[model samples]
Target: MSEQDLAGKVAVVTGGGRGIGRSIALYLARAGADVALCSRSNGEIEAVGEEVRALGRRALAMAVDVAEWEPVESFARAVVAEFGRIDILVNNAGGGFEVTPLAESTPQGWREAVEINLFGTYHMIRACLDDIPAGGKIINITSGMGLEPRPGNSSYSAAKAGAHMLTRCLSLEIWDRGIDVNDIIPGLVATTNVDWAKDRSSVESVLAEFEGKSPPFAPSERVKHPDELGELVLWVASMPAGGPTGQSFSLARRPF
Candidate 1:
């Protein structure tokens, strides 16, 4: 409602079609950043772009699969061409139920998870490296599970943990260049994924049995919302000059 940081900046949010990604995109736009939204679906992302424009900031929506190198590169180039430069990159497009036990998981499923969660992030980071100028920021969406392993989420946990490390490594490597890189480990947030499970009686049954707790831990007293995560992201991305970098922060109150 008032003038905020990130005004006149340009940001790209992968998986900006819906859920947390959509929240992040809108948050940035509201803060006055020209935003580019990308996802595998054009319609949903375009809808998000419309919201960005309504916020009085320029918007571009592109259908892109971050796992694919070519499309990722093209998306980066398009963002630069349309906005002139990239000031922020949010690698948020990664998740799935395929994080089953190793014995029950298929090789293809394993690779797919890794490719999308790990390699996809790599592609976007690589493509945007040159476009990110001094004072730019890179934020990777990691899972709390990545900080502490989830027994049944081998694939998801591995990829996210790798991504967390990747963020730190990139931060160290690029700090001298004046680019900041950080990772956020968000705990359970009520998103469409949770909604889908709620629709399926089986998922609901499982959840009910757990008493709202993640495995290996007590039931979560509260679940975070997507917009909550988005707010934290917008704040960090729009941090004033000399803000912290090469660090990881968790959204949940869990002691870690």
Candidate 2:
């Protein structure tokens, strides 16, 4: 808040309607960047867009489904036309429709998982690559489930794993372009998608339930708020040229 570190930069954020995406977009806007954000929900994204404008930064809100190429391509074109260039690209539109084990999961749901989580990230990068100049940044939202194995959520695990590889490969291919590509592993965040927070009335309640001994994680592990991720993203985005690329910045204390 003290310094407008991202001033005059143009940022494009997918899944900007809510949760982590919304927090990232707002953080960028607060740092004085213009934002072009999209999600499937018109009203939700529009509301976020208004908030950006209120922060005295520009906003372009669109209803987009990133899993589809045509719309994403069109959105990229529109962003270039409206904002001139994109200094930051955040690929955040993804979720697992089927968390069931492979046998119990419908093929439709499994494919949906890959299409949105893996293919969607690729689509955004391909669409926006040309418009992103040197020194620009592409941040992919990744998951620990991708780096490891998930018993009941194989589909999501595989999809995120694919995305993680894509991030690394793309970094090697584009490092010469002066564009830094990396991933952010958010760890255990208290979003609506999380089981513990889904039924809980507040984040406080969720934290209380997990206090002293959070399951599936070490007892010392603590759940994070979406804003914590926003702050982490800002730090990464604020890094100067020649910083770490092809690396996954993890919030979790996993040894791996």
Candidate 3:
């Protein structure tokens, strides 16, 4: 694809304040797409919006909690009003809110994980579907844990697993509309979300801790940079119209 492959397009990235969302948002902007991004962090979202503007693209940043239908609906309206249409939507706002064992976890906390990871994705897509004309792309950021269950992360696993199926089901339902819906599994990323330290500011700094070795979770797996996922997302986003849909693209060494 050319450097300006996404020129004139508008992309919406959730959890765009930092980590994978931050990288993907900037990558789309550098490729010539105007970006509309949101996250719960007002300062982080606004900072990313400025970065997009600095790269010479229009940007709309808001403090939106993707799990809430009202905010998501409002965001969709704002995007249409500001950018006129939505060309790409990246559903990346997710987390293991309560990482306790399912048997011992509180009902609300366990459900909150599903609410954010799965319902949040649904809200963004439903809200923006009308504005996304033919040839639009919807990429859901999934996880290996979703494909295969992980201990103490039952809620996130269940939520992402649901999203995985949603991508496939949505693609089949929307095939006639010419939209491509797919999943991106960013395995062992060095995002603060994965790091136990909770210090999520710099991707490179986190990766540095693992230098020439692998992360503890996977003895043979090397942690990946957030920018690498950006590259993969760019490739998927740059695919020709009417291209592949309902597929899972992964960046991990281990098999899912």
Once superposed on the true structure, which residue ranges of model 1 sit more than 4 Å away at CA? 1-3, 195-197, 200-218
- Tens digits of per-residue lDDT for model 3 on 90-110? 999998568888788999998
Against the reference, the lDDT scores of all candidates come to 0.83, 0.87, 0.91
lDDT per residue for candidate 2 within 4-103, as digits (tens), equals: 4999899999999877888999999888899999997799899999999999999999998899999999999999999999999999888865867788
What is the clash count for each candidate, in the order shown?
A: 1, 0, 0
Ranking of models by lDDT? 3, 2, 1
- Winner on lDDT (1 vs 3): 3
TM-score of each: 0.90, 0.93, 0.96
Q: What is the C-alpha RMSD of each candidate to the true structure, in Å?
A: 3.5, 2.0, 1.4
Q: After superposition, how far is residue 133 of candidate 2 from its true place, in Å?
A: 0.1
The residue pairs in collision within model 1 are 213-219
Candidate 2 TM-score versus the reference: 0.93
Error of 3 at 193 (Å): 2.0
**Top model by TM-score, which number?**
3
Writing each residue's lDDT as its tens digit, candidate 1 over 1-256 gives 3435788999999999887898899999888899998998899998999999998999999999888999999999999999888999999998755857999999888888888888989999999999898999999998776778668768888888899899988988998889999998767665666532344234235445445556344354345557887898997897765678878867776765
